[model samples]
Target: MKYPSLKNYINGQFVASNSARTIKVVSPVDGALLSEVTMSSAEDLNDAVEAARIAFHKWSKTPIKERVQVFFRYKFLLEKNLQELATICSEENGKTMSEAIAEIEKCIELTEFATSLPQIVTGEVLEVSKGIECRTEHVPLGVVASIVPFNFPSMVPNWTIPNAIALGNCMILKPSEKVPVSSGRIAELLKEAGLPDGVFNIVHGDIEIVEAICDHPGIEAVSFVGSTKVAKLVYQRATNNYKRCLALGGAKNHLMVMPDAIATMTAQNVVASMSGCAGQRCMAASAMVGVGPIDHIIDKICDEARKVVPGENLGAVINKESKDRIEKYITEAEQQGAKILVDGRGAKVDGKGGGTYVGPTVIDHVTPDMAVAKEEIFGPVISIMRTNTVDEALAIENANPYGNAASVFTQNGGVARYIIERASAGMIGVNVGVPVPREPFSFGGWNESRFGVGDITGKSSIEFWTKLKKSTIKWNPEAGVNWMS
Candidate 1:
């Protein structure tokens, strides 16, 4: 099922790119040519930025309540076409149907959160002195942009769009060229939901466009989600240009299991965490540390992993390069003396021999120094390590540079609390594998996982996309005055 050639969404119009270079949007499911996206040039990016800059003046002054109505219609349209969006995401991203659906559901959830902007985007006021009043209002930044990764085509872009626009800021989105189809569809929905022209835009490209976004002076801030290397570079470039930026990087997330953890339940969650989305997500459990004597749990995890059939239980990796990279890590771990308990290399899907499928692979006896154990493989592979105590397990986790998320699987509340307090990661899960916080809690990581002052979602995003404007007024001469006055 080939799709039409993709176009850039600029100023609320689907404009075809003039760039000579184009990228083939191949379906990782079966190596089919789904679409061809034009590589948007830096000139295209400038056009988008200018459009957003022009729209920001009116959009920023638009009342918060009116801005929220767009999201209300957006949420309804998203739910109305949930299946279509999920299918597009699943085809382009190679995630399973259920996973794709869940991604859209998350987008809808964020849209629902954006609809509450009228209530939450409130200001503070107080009479600090006689005849003098001080107050603070959350005002939108002029123009902002979000560079979203391909792993989550719809959900990740929504991470910034709904909140940023609902708060009255215009946004430019650079969707990964690998999976740009869903974002174009999303752009249509936003327009149908009555988002004004130039309020939101989508440009497709690789590094050139990314660097353009960072260097574009018209943009007031930037939000990025990608690999650690790129995330850091984006943060530096954006900040160097004196723009507020938040760049969420890659993670080597660890899931530690205690001896007291329920073997069946723990194994299921561990397997799901490592194999979900083919383990391409940042929140995936790539490192599994068994604290104390938990051979039974390890065996159970391996057993559960073995049952995850490619294309049935687990989806394919993004592409052949990712599949080869994951297999290389697995092979290296085996050569480095780790046990390949369940090898996913060369896994195949029925009638889809060209598909890039990697089954659920389990590597046991992995040490801290192995590349598979230390680095982010971004695949459906779990490296199992053993530690005698929780301290040792956490020591290994803490030593890792990326601190996106860490989870503890145990029934003991004391041990859970102990790990929670010292996990070093920004997000922690007790008995939960993927610890992505729901709405209202905000989502971000510490250390290298995130670069910037605030998170990309929830209330923190409100702060990221808007600036505080404080006003101090004196209606009349005051008899007494304080230092603030």
Candidate 2:
């Protein structure tokens, strides 16, 4: 399938970048050449920032009722083009069709959430003293930007776009060069949804563009989702420039299986957690702890993992480099004495000879000292560790530096509670593998998984995207009333 010409969307128009350097967008599904994205220059980023700056004046003043109307229309247009977006997402990112559709569905859900800003964005009013009242209002920041990762082209960009724009802030988005096609489609849909010109823009590039976004004086705030190393850099640079920033980083999420866990359910959820999206997601579970005697459940997990075929059940990793990196981890773990219960090396789809496929891999008896048990593989691989007690399991979880998410599977509420309260991750689950919070609950992590304050979604997003403006008023001073008199 031929894709639309990849170009920078600045000032509401699809324009070619000033930079001559370009990168080919290859489909991870079959290694087909999808498109060539221009490596947007610093000048191109300037154009986008300028466009957002220009739009912010009118957009920020636009009534909240009117601002939400655009999101309402966007939600409809996203639903209308759901299938096309999903196909683009799956082809470029190498997730399954179902997962791609689910990502777009998440985008739609966030758009729906954005529409509720009219009701939820209200301020507070209280009487501080007699005849004196103070009130606070949520006000939009002028020009803001979001730097989204490649894993979820639609969902991650939507994470900031909906809330930022709905709160009346104009936005410039820098999408990962790997999966730029879906973002172009999103730009078109937002335009169709009646979003005003320059209200939202897309600039495509590599590190240069990222540095530009971080340093651009016109941009008031920045949101980022990527590796912890890069996330920290972006956060420091953006905040150094005195812009509000939230940078979500990498994770090595863990899942604990207690002795009382239902074998079938635990196996299903554990496999799904590690293998979903080829384990490209930050929320994907990479480590599993078997507390007490759960060898029976571990055997079931291995069986389920073996059943996951590359093309049928599991999807390819982002590229050949990612595939090689994931396999290296598996090989190193095996050499370090960890057992490869279900090896995924050399897995492939018959017709997709060039696809970067890696089947579901499980490494058992992975000690904390092993590199595989420590680093983020960012692939469909699971490292299993055994512990004799729940404290040991919780200790393993807490010791890990990345605290994005942790889950425990047990019928016992006390065990679940103990883990939930002690787990260092910001998101916790009982019997749920992926514990991404639903709408209005906020999504974020503690420690290395996240940087800056507040979350990137739900109610927390409103705060990240907007500023609080408080007004204290006294129409007439009452004589000797409180200290103000």
Model-by-model lDDT, in order? 0.93, 0.92
Model 2 segments more than 4 A misplaced: 477-482
Model 2 per-residue lDDT tens digits across residues 200-266: 9999999999999999889999999999999999999999999999999999998999999999999
Off by over 4 Å in 1: 478-485
> How many clashing pairs in candidate 2?
0
lDDT of 1 by residue, 17-134 (tens): 7698998999999999999999888889888988998998899889999999999999999999999999999999999999999999999999999999788878999988777888
Candidate 2 accuracy as lDDT: 0.92
Query: Model 1's lDDT to the true fold?
Result: 0.93
Residue pairs clashing in model 1 are: none
